[model samples]
Target: LAPQPKAPPSPPAPQALELPPNASPVLSSGPSPPPAPKASQPPPSGPSPPTAPKAAPPPPPPSKSGGPLPPPPALPGSSKTRPPPLMKSGNKTDTDEDSSEAKTKLKPFFWDKVATNANKSMVWDHLKAGSFQLSEDAIETLFGCNADKKSGDAKKDIASKEAAQVVRILDPKKAQNLAISLKALSVSAEEVSCAVKEGNELPSDLIQTLIRWVPSTDEELRLRLYTGELSQLGPAEQFLKAIFDIPYIYERLDALLFMAGLPEETSNVKQSFATLEMACEELKNSRLFLKLLEAVLKTGNRMNVGTFRGGAQAFKLDTLLKLSDVKGTDGKITLLHFVVQEMIHSEGVRSARAAKEQTGSVSSVDNNDLIEEEYKQLGLQAVSSLGDELQNVRNAAILDADQLAMSVASVVHRLGKTKEFLNTSMKSLDEDSGFHRKLVHFVEQSQTDVTFLLEEEKKIRSLVKSTVDYFHGRTGKDEGLRLFVVVRDFLAMLDKVCNEVKEASKVTPKKTKTEFPHTQVFSRSPA
Candidate 1:
């Protein structure tokens, strides 16, 4: 069988062009290569002038021994047309009349392009566009800052540069510190990710610092921070632990989500399901849910549907659904709140209709009385909403000890971080906030009262203790500590409310210095 079939010949391999060490491009003698067509130049025409071969230009002056090519001199008839005249420039060299120089000059070096004495607003605009281009030394000099701002370099280094440029040139460590200390953002504040090249933690203390800076105190920020910290927290569990203790609901929400190993919202259906559910919870919170009511009311300025039941969680659409049902339980509160205003409005209309009828001015305080009633109802419902939220979370997930410790640490961390805790508006100086602050001071000063229930070897009575226990049971120390932060927040809110109650009886002694705007609508009728 082997002898019967002759061996098949192999096909030849394709040859490749390999240049030798001393090889140069081979030129064809048949005809000189058509001179490279000039960009935007007309082609040559007419009979050939001569058949003699033209000599190639000498190999470009051997590249000046190690420098770039000396540009070729203009050949007699190389281009039919003369080049355009160049402008005289103070910073440019004048070339020969026949030189084939490009009209535009070489760009100045990077240094020449800097804004040494640029206006702050001009630089600010550039920075806003992410175009910072200055060196650190240049930046410092321009801003009139030195390394020590009691005269520090930071104050001096405020030069114009692209955001990316400054971030790129600085020592990552120093840059990160400056970024935090300045309260300015090159991009979004959170995008200033400190380079963690060699260590486990960010040397600038970004996590701990942001934990302190996150603008939250009410259910709002506490709630948002809980969610914000979830995605960006990295493998540095200890740093995360430090921030995890922040006393905010949102921060705790972040802790719980991560502790339960809830994957972030992604294209994956499973992860999306979890994120959407929490978002849904937020939408139902009284503040957010109330917007829907406000939206419906605004169409008619304010509306009145008497003797019906309603709630913070109930949508107006739901109320409409219940309109035909047996006695609406809370619709009556909505009615009573809006009824006076609406009745006055109706009276105004009727008075107008009769032309001769007279109507008295509707006092603004009529709306205000209803507003105070709404405030009490709203506060109660808000506090109740939190209680329900905690219940829902506890029912939904169990956290590990590491996660719990992380959460508690974030809270305890922020408590010591700031010299003062003031809401970020001009109204922070109002009477209502003064009493509020005093109350907080009272609670914070009395650690015993704060921890009175911790003395219990028996039932863990306080919200903080219970929250910690819940985390400790499964998650471990870190996350449990974080949960404790949430517990403290809940307790703090409880204290604030209790203090406000005490304040309501006393005249203005218990008022907060901060003044939030008051509503003019009632949330519920008094029992």
Candidate 2:
């Protein structure tokens, strides 16, 4: 072949491609590796087609300073796309394309945006400002999340969150207890209505339970608004809704409390009246008690012989207690001890005389030891039994006049509220409505009963005042019970003195007999 187209010299090995020091792997489209040198082969029959010149590598992107750009950051993981290079211009850096790409990638996880506090705050703001409807789950979550966080605008927060109804939701145990208690009551609206109208008493416990379950304002409003099937509601809600069917449910509940408490309250008033009456009778009519007073009066008069207080007609019952405080010439023996000894001797003499009369003969020996022994035994028994005779006075001493009055006033005030309710709340009902008619009739009857109670209370109080004046000669501003308290205290002191005298008689019988003078005779009435 034309001198054999001498074997064409192997094409000079392609020069190794060069890259910038900081350059990353070139993109696939940037350039292709020079075709591998053809396997060593005999020269081609014809000259190899003129070699094409390699395309110059595309110019590197320009930088602000017109220098070679640094390599773009390696993409995260195996991502094939690279973010746009950041461009610095003055103090501001522009990454608009990078930001756009990021936003596009984040769209798939849009809900994750709410995990941030800033985003959550925005959601709360919108929830409060707008009428955004929330599912029960959302409401529960909202309430649970902020339940412990105290906000300055607490009422507004509660209103926005509808927190009033969430109380039961948050405490399922309490809600369950309430439901159980309501079911246990098993009271029907009809029963309540009939009970109120007919003046029949429901169980006080039931009324009290109902009181505890009284709906809050929001809960009441909700119950009033709900018109759905009762079967769909919880037991507590159903009960509340059923009761709401009655007009003026709250006022009716108040009436129920008043009615339930009526018998006990009235009985208490009557019991107080009886107590005052018995106390007055005991104080006025007990003969032994009067005799003790006379002995005390005599002792006081003898002591006050030279003073203006000498020989007074009668002394205050309060002075009887002070007798123990006045010691005799012998400090060991108190004035009360002397009075007790004197009373014992007088009681013994009366017993002996009564025995003499009963047997129709006087004993020949006036100082017989057996008679003296019988006298001492009778005197101790009679004096110690004084507490039993004045039992009602002891009971009266504990009575609080103000409390008794308040009990009556409470009944009146409750009745007044019931009447007010009938005028205002029940006024809208038809006159023929059984509930309205029954409640009105019941209130009228209660008014009459309470009127009688009021009269009785006044009569009993007047009797108490009169009795106080009868004993004290003047009725002071203090409660009548004060007089009973004084008597009760004096009786306590007298009991103690009698015990000491009996112990002394046991220790030194002869000495005690001599100390007790037989001159004084205690009659059944005060001198």
Best by TM-score: 2
Worst 10 residues of 2 by lDDT: 103-112
State the lDDT of candidate 1 residue by residue for 325-440, as single tens digits: 32225553333223223222323333233332234444332333333334343344443344344443332233333433343344334433321332322134443433234334
**TM-score, predicted candidate 2 vs. hidden true structure:** 0.59
Look at candidate 1 and tell me the lDDT of residue 38: 30
TM-score of 1: 0.17
Best by lDDT: 2
Flag regions of model 2 displaced more than 4 Å.
1-201, 226-238, 308-311, 329-331, 362-370, 420-424, 431-441, 502-512, 515-527
- lDDT (Cα, tens digit) per residue for candidate 2, span 387-484: 89999999999898889899999888888988988887778664455556767777888998899889989988888888888877774665657888
How well does model 1 score by local distance difference test?
Answer: 0.35
Measured on C-alpha atoms, candidate 2 has an lDDT of 0.70
